[model samples]
Target: MKILVYGAGAVGGYIGAHLIENGLDVTFLARGGHLKNIVDKGLNIVLSNQEKIVHPSYATDSLATLKNVKFDVVIVAVKAWQVRESATEILPYTSSSTLMISVQNGIDSPYELNDVFEARQIIPSVFRGICLVSEPGVVSVPSQCSWTLGEFQKNPTRAINSLLKPLIGSKLQLKVSIDEDIIKDLWKKLALIAPMSGVGALTRSVLGVCLEIKELRNMIEKAVEEIIVVAKSQNIILPDETLENSMGFYRALPYSATSSMQRDIEQKKPSELEYQTGAIVKLGKSNNVQVPVNSFIYYSLLPQELAARSDLR
Candidate 1:
């Protein structure tokens, strides 16, 4: 099947590399030095034990270059804030049969896609992995990665099956699952990540440091509670044990582990603050739920976020 991996950064590049390694037809849409590196020397994927390099069927920074080609599946792996713009750019290359996968961190990317594409064409997914781009065109996967996919609404099962078929038997130690209730999966991830990321950014520390301090740990707990209430306000009732489960997940992580959002903020790059922690505050207000903890976290980090985005003036 023909697939296009847009925003071929760490996540997209890693997935694209795997697909190409399995002999599937794949194209990559990336830009800047990363694009140059891939086009010149193929994409590199560094695993725990070894490294693999796979060149895609095609790689281009401009969609205009692929104007005549139609893609069967388009994986939207851009930042949460870049989803809508990416959707608009890729729309002309998709036909009625195209399946667009939303693999961003927040709960809003699918809705953002809905504005440009039909709901049936969108598959919302949650991705879990410890991966990053160590340099141009090189992705590092320190551990196994997994994806949980679910439809925004009822879609043709055959089409979904076709998309999953190539990924099933790969030697790449990747796990993929289909969830009947994907919304719950999205909220569960948000509950864990938003609090962890916000608190980590505020303190400029890793997950272990935040959890080790009494005051910061309490702040993290409160932030998680605030997200739970906000999720319920939207009629997406998370499990009663969400708080405990989230804490357990946090504790299990390596002490030095940091989130993508935290890393971006530390690098003074644009982050998903608005879509993750900030989304909680906005959703809570709209649903008449109180989320003071998240509000404080959001506002506390807004200055740095703005500065990074160059909107601080």
Candidate 2:
């Protein structure tokens, strides 16, 4: 099956490198220095133990170059905010049978893609792992990577399995599973990430430091509760134990671990703040759910986020 990894950043780059290593037909759509490095030096994946470099079947920044190629699977690995634009850009290369996978941080990506493609053609996925682009053309995987993908409206399980079958048990340390209800999985992950990232960015600290302080830890717990309430407003009932379970998951993470959004905010780069934390605030307002903790987190971080995107007025 021909696959196109649309945004070859940390997540996309890591997944594409593994697919290429296994001799699959994959093309990467990337831009700027990352694109140049991949074209010249190939894609490099750094694991905990060893490093592997594999050249993709094709990699290009120009969509016109592949105008005639119809991709079977298009993995939309871009940031949450970039999903809609990315979907429009890749539309010319997608046929009715194309499966567009949404593997972004927030819950809005699949819906965003639905504006461009049929809901039946979209697979909502959640990526769980510690991976990042250490440098141009290079991706680092410090922990195991797993994906939970689910169908929306139509059952594309057979097609989805066929597309991901190759990477299932490879030495890439990757895991793949299909969930019956992926929206709940997405909210569960958001409950953990949105609060952690929002609090981490505001404090400019790691997970350990954030949890060490009593006030910050309390805020994080309340933030998770806020998200749960918002999800319930949409009729997605998260487990009653979500708050405690999320805290336990956070505690198990490496002390130095930081969310990608937190790191981006620290570096003054554009982040998923608007899509992750801010999305909860918007949902709460629309649904009449009180999310003071998330509201403080979002509004407090707004100026910096606007500044990072060069819209700080």
Candidate 3:
């Protein structure tokens, strides 16, 4: 089966490298310096214990080169802000039979993918890991994290099975569940990340640091509560212990465990503020719920995010 991994950034590069090591036919969609680095030096994944380098079957910057080639599966591993552009680029390479997987951090991506392709053809998933692009072609994944996948609605027969069949024997941890469970999964992740992201970025602190600052920790809890209210308004109810468990995660994190969003803001790079904390504010508005803390955080970070994007341009 031919697999196309759109955007060979940290998430895509890490996943694509593993698939290549497991002997899968995978191609990466990259651009400019990243694409050149991959062609010249191949892709490298550095971990705490070991480093893996793999030259994929093909790596190119242009989608036009892939005309008439139908991919069996297309993994959309771009940032939430890049999803729309990546979807448009990968459209020509997909046929009606192609399966699409969205591995982004936000909750709105599944619906966004449905706009580009059929809902049935899209599988939504949430991933956990501390990964980043250290350089042009080198990606780092410091931790091993599992992936949770499901359709927007339950399907007796899912394309996820076929998509994951190739990596079945590998060490990839993939969990499959029904639609309701997946919705809960998304909300649960949001509950953990939205607050962590808001507090982390706003305070310019890591998880451990936030744990020490009472006010920052309180802000994190407020963000979680607001998100829970929004989730319930949408009929997605998480467990009663969700908030407490989420807080426990923050408290247990290493002193230096910084969130990706926090790191991006500190480095003045574009962050996923829109879909992470911004989503909470939007949902709260629509649900007629009050998310004062999240609103403060979102608006506070907007200027930074906008400025970073402008600078990149």
Estimate the TM-score of every prediction.
0.94, 0.94, 0.90
Which scores better on lDDT, 1 or 3?
Answer: 1
User: Model 3: per-residue lDDT, tens digit, 1-313?
Assistant: 8999998888788778877877889999988887899999999888767787789999988777876799988889988888887788788888997878888887988888888898878878777656778888988766665566676656667555554667444333222233437767888988998898888898887788888888888888988998888999999988999889998876655677877778888999898899899998998898899999999999999988989989424
lDDT of 2 by residue, 166-268 (tens): 6555557777787789999999989989999999999999999999999999999999999999999999999999999999988988898899999999999
Candidate 2 ranges beyond 4 A from true positions: 156-167
Model 1 clash pairs? none
State candidate 1's TM-score.
0.94
> Model 1: per-residue lDDT, tens digit, 161-255?
65566754444556777877898889999998999999999899999999999999999999989888888888889999999999998897778
Q: Rate the local accuracy (lDDT) of all candidates.
A: 0.88, 0.88, 0.81
Candidate 2: residue 66 lDDT (0-100): 79
